[model samples]
Target: MRDRSTGHPRNAWYALAASAEVGSTPLGTRALGTPVVLYRAGDGSVVALGDRDAHRPYPLSLGHVDGDTIVSGYSGFAYDRTGACVRVPSQAQVPYGARVPSYPVVEEGDLVWVWLGEPSLAALRPPVSTPWLTDAGWDTFGGAWETAAGIGLLHDNFADITHVAVVDPVISPPALTGVAPALEVELTETTVHFHRDWPAAPLPEWQAKISGASTTASYPQREEGAFLAPGLWADRWDVFIPADEGGTQTFRFTHAVTPVDDHRTRHLWRVSRNFAPGAEASDVLRPIFESYYLKVREILETMQQVIDRDGYGEDVNVAADLAALQVRKILRRLVADEG
Candidate 1:
C-alpha cells in the first residue's frame, strides 16, 4: 500500500474528463489536489490551466470563454490559451506576473489527459492507448463518478474478482462463491497482467439476456486484464457461448482513476462490446452499466467510511489477492521513484 503522507505522484498523466464532456464551456475540476480548468480552443483542442485567477484568486471556470481566451468573471481579466494575461479591462497595460500556470494536455481515444508535473518531463511519457473506444467495429457506453474512496482501493477492486460474487451476485456466476480459480500472473516493469480460465458454468441471467444464450446453457469463460498504468486499467471477458457463426462474444472494460485529494477520487469507466455496434445497442446497455457501477460505488464508499472511523489495520492476504498485491507493489514503487 502507498504511504498516505507521500500524496499522489505528480509525474504522470491523469484523465481529466471525457472528450464529449469538454466543449466551449469551462469545466472546473481538481486533480492531484490542485484546482484545474479545462476548455477547448478555437480549433477544438483541449487547454488545461490553473483554475484560480492570478489577480483575485477567484475560480476561472466561473468565467466565460472568448474566441480563444477565457475571461474572468470577477475582474474581467482575460487569459489566452497559453495562460498569459493578454487583456485587462480596467487598465491598458497587462501587469507583469499576472498569468496563471498552464499544463500540457492530450486528447486521444475519446479522453482528455493532462500532465500535472514538470513541463519538461511531459514529453518523456504519454498516456496509455485505448483505441478500442473509438474503433468502428465496437459499441461503447460509460459514465463517471465522484468516489469517496482512494485511488488504490479502486485499483484493488479491479485486480481481484472474487469479490464480484459477494458484491454483485446478479452478474457473477454462482459457482464463483467460495471457489478459487487457478490464476496466471505476468509482470513487467510498469504493468501486471492476470488471466483465469473458468470451467463450463451456467450463464447468469443478465449475461444470458445480452448474449442471446439460454440461462440453462453452460459455457467456458476466459477473464484477462492488465494494469496499464497508474491511471488506467483494461480488462476483457470471452464467453465461449456458441454464436450463430460458431464464435464467442467479447466484452471489454476499461477504468481510468484519478485522485482528487487524499480522501477522494475520480473514476471513469467504459464498456465496449464487439457483438453490438450501433447507437441503439449503446442506448440499451447504458442504464444497465450505470446500475452495475452504482452498486460498486456504494460498497466502496461504505468501506471508506469504516476505514476512516477506525484506522486501517494490518492486511492479511490470500491466494485471491495475488494480482491486487502486485498492483499495490507497483504503485508504491512509482510513487517512491517520483519522490
Candidate 2:
C-alpha cells in the first residue's frame, strides 16, 4: 500500500471545478492538498493562482476580483492573473518576492483544470476530454461535492461496480451479486478499460426513467468504464430493452477526483445523455439525475466510514474486484513514477 502522505501525482491536470462555478467571484478550494484560487479574467479566460496571500496569509479567494487582477481585502494587495503582485496600496515600489504563484489552467470538457506541477508539463497533456459534455446533442449536468474518502478509494468505487450489489442495490438489482460477469480488460499506457455486460438485468428506477423503458422489463445492459491515470474515471452505460431498439439510451458518466488532503477529496461528477438532447434535457431529466448522483455520494460517504473503522486488505477479493485491483496496480506505478 502507498503512504497517504505520498499524496497524488502533481504533473497531471486535475479537474478543479465546473466551468460555471468560476464566474465573476473567485472560487477557493484545495487540489492535491494545495490551496488554489480560481476566477475568470476580463477576457473571459480562467485564471488560477495560489489561494493564500504570501504577505498576510489571508486567502486571496476571500478577496474580490478586479478586472484582470485579484484585490486582497486585507492591506489592498493586488495580484494579476499571472500571480504577479502589481499593486501595493501603501508602497510605491513592490518587492520582487511579493507575488503569489500562478498555476496553469485550461477550460475544457465543461470543466476547469489546473496544473499543480512543472508548468512545462501542462502543455504535454490536456485535461480529461469528455466531448459529450460539450456536445449540443448531449444533455449534461454536473457539480462538485466533497467526500471523506481519499481519492484512491473513491476511484476504486468507480473501477468496481460489484459494490453496487451490497452498497447500492437500489441502483441496480442484487442479481449482479450472485452472478459472475465475464469481464474483458483493455490495457493502455495511461488508462485501463473494463467491458462488462449484465444479461437480462432489470433496470433501476432511474435508468428506467432516462431510458424511456418499462421499469419491470429486463434488458441486456453493457457498460464500458475506464480508469484514467492520476485521478479520473469515466463509464459509458448502454441500457437496451430487448424489443424496443429505439428505446436504448446511452449515458456517459465522468468523475474527476482531486485530493484536497490525505483523507478528503473534492469530486466533480457529470452525467450526459443523448436520448433527450437540447435545452429540454434539464427540464426533463436533470432533477432525477442530480438525485441519482447525490445518492452515490451518500454511498461513498458511508463506505468511507466503514473503511475508517474496519479497514481494507483484510477483506477477501472476489472475481468482481479484478478491475479495481488492476487500477490499484496502475495507480501504484503512476505514483512511483512521479516520485
Candidate 3:
C-alpha cells in the first residue's frame, strides 16, 4: 500500500477489509505493526488512522459523499476527508459536541491507506514487503506459538524445519536431517520467490512432526519482503488467497505471533473456506479433520506453557533462519528509513 500524498508505504501497509455501507464498520487492526482504526465510506472507500482507542469510538472515516465533511463517530464529530474537523458536534443543530483528533486517509485498490506519520516523512517510509492474499476460495488457518526467543527468533524458526525432529511426533521432512536439498530464493522489488517444494510423504510419522511449513512455492506477496510463487508452494504450505465474492477457499496452515508487549503475546487464528458453511472437508480428511483442530490446539497450548514457565534463549541456527533474517533486516530498514 502507498501513501496517497507521498506515495510511500512506510506510512501505511494494510487496507481496510470492510465494505462501505453507511452502517458498515470493521474491527480495527494492526498493520505493519502499527495499531490503527479502520472505517469505510458509503461510496466505497476505506480510511485508516493511527489512533485506536475503541472506547472513545472515534471514527477515522465515515463514508462521506459530499467530497468533504465526514461523520466521524457515535460521539459526533464531522471532519473533512483530509481529517480536518469540519463540523463540531456541539455546534450541530443541537449542542453536545465531542473533541478528538483525526488524520488524513485515502482508499485505493483493495487496501486502505492512512497517513499516520508526519506528512513530511511519509515519503521516506519505503516499501518493505508485498502481500499475496486473494479474494478467491481461500481458507486461512492460523495459530500462535511461543518461541524460545523473540519475534526475531520466531522468524528464524519458520525459515527452516530442523527442530521438528524433536518437537513433532509424526510429520517429518526428510531433508531436515541437514541433508535436504537447498531451498531456492528469488528476490525482486515487489516479490520474493522461495520456490522449493521438497517432497513429503503422507504418512502418520510425517504428519505428527509438523508444526510449521518452510518448503513451498507459495508465499505472501505483501509489498514488504514480497514472497509470492504460483502453484502449490509445498506439500504442507498452501496459502489460499481469499477471493472477492467471499467465495470458498482454504488456508493450508501455519503459525504467527502478536506481541502483547516486550515479553507477552496474544495468539488467535481461524481456518476458513469459500464453501457454504455446511460443507465438509474433502472426503479424504473429512472423517478426521474435525478432530485434528482440537488436537492441534491442545498441542500448541502446551507449547506456549513451556515458554511461559521456562522462558527462552537461543543458541543454534539453521538454514531456514536465513530468509527470516533477511525479512527482518529489510523491515528494520523500512522502519528506520521512515524515521
Candidate 4:
C-alpha cells in the first residue's frame, strides 16, 4: 500500500481548467501541490507556467497578457509563452536564470490538461480521449468544484457506484439498492473498468420524462465506467426503453480530478447525453446533475474532515471495493515508481 499522506503521482496529466475558463487573462490554479498560471498565447494555444515571477517571486497570474507574453505586475518583467524572461525593465540584459517552469499543456474536447511530470513523457501518453464531450451528437453541460478533500477519496467514491443508492437516492434508481446487480471488473496497466447490468430497474423521474415513459416504468439499465488514470474517470449509462417510448437513451458522465494539494482537490464533472440535443434539455438537466454532485462533494469533504480529526481506524473493505482497491494498488505502484 502507498502512503496516503505522501501525495499524488507527479507523472500524470491533470485537467487544470475548462477551456472556456482560460481565454485572454491569466487564470491562477494549482496542480500536484504547485501553483500554476494558465493563459492563452497569441495563437490561441493554452500555456501553463509557474505562477510566480523568477525575479521577485510575485504571482505572474496577477500580471497582464500582452500578445504572446505576460508582463509581470510586480516587477514589470515580461515572460514569453515558453517561460523565457524576454524583457526586464530594470536591466538591459536578461539574467541567465530568469525563466519559470513551463508545463506541457494539451487542449482536448472542452478541457485543458497540464502535464506536471517529465516533459518528455508527456508526448508519449497524452490525456485520455473524451469524444462525447466534443461530438456534435451529444448534448453536454457541467462545471467544476473545489472540494476540501483528497483526490483519492473522490476516486474511491467514483469507482464504487453502490454508494449512489445511499448518497444520491433521489436521482439514482431505486433498484441500485436491495439487490446485487451482475458486476464485471477489468484491470489494465493504467486503467480499471467496471460494468454493471440490471434488468427491470425502475427509472428515475427525470429520465422517465425524457423517454416519455411513466414515472413508475421499469427498464433494463446498464452502466459501464473506467478509471482512466489518476486524473480522469468516465462512465456511461444506458436505459433500454420500448420503441414506442423513445427506444434507448445513453448518458456519459465524466469526472476529472486534479489535486490542488494532498488535502484539497479540484473536481470537474460533465454530462453528455445522446437524447434531446438542445439548449432546453441542457437547461433542464444541468441543475439536477449539479445538485447531485454537490451532495457527493459534501459527503466526501465531511469524510475527509472526520478522518483528519479522528484518524482512519481499522478501515475495512468488502466485495464491492474490488475496483477501488485495484485503483489504489495501481496508484501505489505508479507513485512508487516515480520515487
Candidate 5:
C-alpha cells in the first residue's frame, strides 16, 4: 500500500492510544501507516515496536506479553522491550540481526505517545500535553474514534465553531453563531491561536451548572481555539454565569489527530472541566458527560464521511470559514515545509 504518511513530518510525536489502553496485552495499531505494537514494560513504562517479526511474517501484536518480553505465538520467539531479539526457540542461538524496529514511546497526560521520527528530534519536542486532564480540581472524560477525512479537516472544523449549529445545536451557545465576536488571531512558529468574546450567549447544561445560571438566560462568554504543529487542536470555552457569588466555568476540549493512512485518521480526544472534580461529581455527571461526548464523536464521524463522499472540490466556503481557511493554509505550508 502507498504510505501517505510520508506527506507529513515525522520529526514530531504522535498520540497512539489512551494511557489506559496499554497493559498486559499487546495493543495492535498503526502510526503514519506503519504497523505498530504497544505494551507496558516490567517497570510499567510504555514500549513500542514494529508489529512484524523479523524472522517470521507473524505480527508481534498477535503474540502475548510475558513480563518484560513479548513472545511470538507461532515460534515462541521472545523479544525484549527494546525490540531486541532475546530468545529464539526455533534455533539454539539467536542471530544478531534478528531484531525488530523499536520506536520511542512515552506515557504523558493520560495518553500514549510514540515518536515516529528522528531519534534526536524526539527529545527536542515531546507530544502535545494537556495539563488540564491531570491538573488539580479538574475532572476529565475522554474517548476516541476514527474518521475518513484527513487531520486537516478535523483541525479546520475546530478552528471554526459555526458548525455547532448543525452538529449539536442544543448545546452550542447562541453567541457562538448569533453574534459575530471580533476575532483576535495570533500565529507563532508552530501554532495558531484565535480568541473571541461574545457579549451574550445562552448557556448549556454543563455551563449553566457551573455558572449557576438559569437555562433560559443568555450570558457573556469567551472562546479560544488553537492549533499546534502537525495535528494537535485545543478549544477553551468559558461562560460567565450570573450568580450571587459571581462565578464562571471553563471547559476545555482537545483533539490529537494521527494519520492512519491517506483516507483514515485516528483521533484521541478529552474534555476537562474545573467545576466538577473526583468521583462524587463523576458519579452523577459521568453518564451525562459520556452521552455528550458520544454525540460529539458522531459529529466528527459524520463530517469525515461527508468530506470523503463529496470531496473538497465540490464544496464551497463562506465568511464563517475564515478560521478554517487559515488552518488549511497553515497545514498546506507545514506539509510543503516537510517536503
Candidate 6:
C-alpha cells in the first residue's frame, strides 16, 4: 500500500476486495483495516458496509436474524437490519436511542454491493447492478497487473493489443513483431474508438507458449484490460474498466485519473455487460464461466510481475503501442480537465 491522497484508504478498501474472495454466498470475516463482517442474511442479501465503530456494540450482522430485522451495526447500542433498535447489548439503556449507520446492501451477478454514499445518503440512492460470471449462462475470467509505473502505463498496455508478444507471450505467440500499430481515435461521448487487430490465422498454442493470448482480436482498453478472443475468455465482447464501487456497478474506467478530490483521482470503470443474467447472449454457465473470468486476473498478475521488473517504455516501439500511448494521454487529459 503506497500512499496517495485522494481517498486512498477508501479506494484501497475496494481494491483489496477486488482482489479478494467473496465466497459462494458464504459467511466469513476478514479485516479490511477494520472489523468488517460479511454475512448472507436469511433473506439472501449480502451485506457489506461500515461495521459499527466497535467500541460501541457488536456488528449488527451478528445479532439474531429475523424476517426484516437486519443487525447492521452498533452505536453505543444495538440495532437490527433496518437500523431499528431491538436490544441493549452494551449499556442498560440504548444511548440517546440513536441508530448505527446503514449501507444499501444488495446481491447481484454473484457479488454483493454496499452503497458508500455516507451512512445517510446511501439509503436514498438506488443500488447499481452489473453482470458477473456467477449468473447463469455467462463465463468470465481475469487477472491483475501493475505496470512499470502508475495507471498511465497500464492504460497503454490494456488499450493497445500490439504488445502481446512481450507482455504475456503465453497468450500471444508469433510475437507481434511490428514496427508500429495503426492508430484511429474518436472523440465522442458515446465511445472512444481505439481498435487493433491480430495476425491472420493466429495459433493459440504458438501464442500460448509466448503470452496470455494467441492473438489480440480486440482488447478492452479501460481501467482494467478486457481482451476478446475466441478462447480463454469470458465472452466475445471485450468489456474493460479501471475501477468499480459497490461490487455490482463497476466503472469501466477508460482514460486515466478521475477525480474523487483535488488531491486524489479515482480510477474509473465501465461495465459493458448487463447485470441481468437473462440478458446474456451465450449459454449460461453462471458459476463455471464466472469462475473462468477469474483466470484472466491470474494471467494479468503474472504479466505485471514481469513488467514491474522490466519497466513500461521501450526504445523500440510498435505503431499499435503508439495508439495505446495516445489513449493514456487522453485519459490523463480527462482526469485533469475534469478536476
The lDDT leader among the candidates is 4
List the candidates ranked by lDDT, beginning with the highest: 4, 1, 2, 5, 3, 6
User: How would you encode candidate 3's per-residue C-alpha lDDT over 238-291 as one tens digit per residue?
Assistant: 233235423222233323233323333333322333343223333323334334
Stretches > 4 Å off in candidate 6:
1-36, 54-77, 82-85, 90-92, 118-138, 141-157, 173-175, 185-193, 206-339
Q: Which window of 10 residues has the lowest lDDT sum in candidate 2?
A: 1-10
Better candidate number, 3 or 4, judged by TM-score: 4
What does the lDDT read for residue 98 in candidate 5? 82
Using TM-score as the measure, the top candidate is 4
In order, candidate lDDTs are 0.85, 0.79, 0.38, 0.89, 0.76, 0.36
Measured over all alpha carbons after superposition, the RMSD of each candidate to the real structure, in angstroms, is 2.0, 2.8, 10.5, 1.6, 3.3, 11.0
Q: After superposition, how far is residue 2 of candidate 3 from its true place, in Å?
A: 35
In model 3, how many backbone clashes occur? Answer: 54
Error of 6 at 245 (Å): 41
Off by over 4 Å in 3: 1-12, 15-23, 29-35, 50-75, 92-154, 163-179, 187-192, 197-200, 203-278, 282-314
| Per-residue C-alpha lDDT of model 2 across residues 1-339, encoded as one tens digit per residue | 323323577888888888889987999998877889999999999999999887788999999998999988786899998898999998999877789999999888788988898898889887777788889877887767888778877876787776665654656543475575788888876788998887776666765665566777677778789987576788988877554445677788888888888678888888888775566555666666566567777877776677677665455777767787787777677778887
lDDT of 6 by residue, 300-331 (tens): 54555555565444446555555455544444
Tell me the lDDT of model 5 at 186. Answer: 83
lDDT of 4 by residue, 72-125 (tens): 999999999889999999889999878999999999999999999999999999
Please estimate how well model 2 matches the true structure, expressed as its whole-model Cα lDDT. Answer: 0.79
lDDT of residue 146 for candidate 1: 90
Estimate the TM-score of every prediction. 0.94, 0.89, 0.51, 0.96, 0.88, 0.48
Model 6 scores worst on lDDT over the 10 consecutive residues at 227-236
Worst 10 residues of 4 by lDDT: 1-10
